[model samples]
Target: MRRLLILFAAAVAAPVLAADPAPEIRRAPVPPQALGVAHTLRTIPEACARLQGEFSGDAAAPYRFAVVRTSPGCRPRARLVDAAQARPSPASGWILNDLIRVPSAACATQQAVVRVWRQPAQVAPPALDPQGRARVYLEDSLQQARAGRLAPLPAYAVSLQVEGLPCPR
Candidate 1:
């Protein structure tokens, strides 16, 4: 009788002890519009190459890479701006121009910046959502454009320390 009670208690407590396990956080790709580009980087050198290709220069310009949270979901956004005020918004799942990691080292920090530009009536600006889902739209074609009619503005960002390349100075 005592053995049966001990077994029952053990069984009951086992499941209870296992309950409330740590929450699993799933990681997804960052959106393009938020970062001005859609590319995912493993290193800062790769990011520099991307930046040079996009802006035609290796020097650092105004840019940002970040993950934004919204009411419905989360997304990444990247953007790049030039000295001529030329801004290009990245498409969904597009490659980023900046790398976030150093050789065999993780990124120290990652951030995203939002830039707004005023265009003429006929001039088309990069698309943006009023509720801030531009990252989603830019990252995923299916998610393009939020409920509002306003197009999302172009944003540029960078991911660091991705595939073991050294981070940019």
Candidate 2:
């Protein structure tokens, strides 16, 4: 009876275990808007400032920013930015790209700056939602606004190594 029960249990679990997991469903892209233009600035900080001003730095709903950096301490460049609160979980936070690892052995440098005339589509801005779901209208609007010529403006930012600052290598 025990051997029969074991066989039965194995048979039941075999189908369940062999079944594939459901694929994650992401939102589809929206259609393009008319050929338009968005005024451009020259740095990620400028982009952050623009959003902050628009949001009026509201305490309850403050504009969030993800500061991206590049290094080697030898070469510096504006990598990418995501407008969302940096969360611990992958599904609910600033999804980071590859880090600009600067080896101290070859490059022992200081002070860096990164800027860009416009944010690219591939590295588009993040339309954050506290609930961590698809933000259709917000993402769509940003996408539309950025899909055009950008008139460059003079705006930039700087970074440095500060003593006593907690950093994760």
- The candidate that wins on lDDT is 1
Error of 1 at 32 (Å): 29
lDDT of each: 0.31, 0.29
Task: Supply the TM-score for candidate 1.
Answer: 0.18
Give the per-residue lDDT of model 2 (tens digit) for 1-169.
5466445645654574354233222223222211122211122432343211111122332212223332224232332323222221235322322111111211122101111122223344456689976566766667767996333333222221111111123
- Model 1 agreement with the true structure over 29-77: per-residue lDDT tens digits: 3332222334333222211223211111122542333332222332323
TM-score of each: 0.18, 0.17
Model 1, runs deviating above 4 Å: 1-95, 104-147, 162-169
Backbone clash total for model 1 is 52
Clash counts per candidate, in order, are: 52, 0
Leading candidate by TM-score: 1
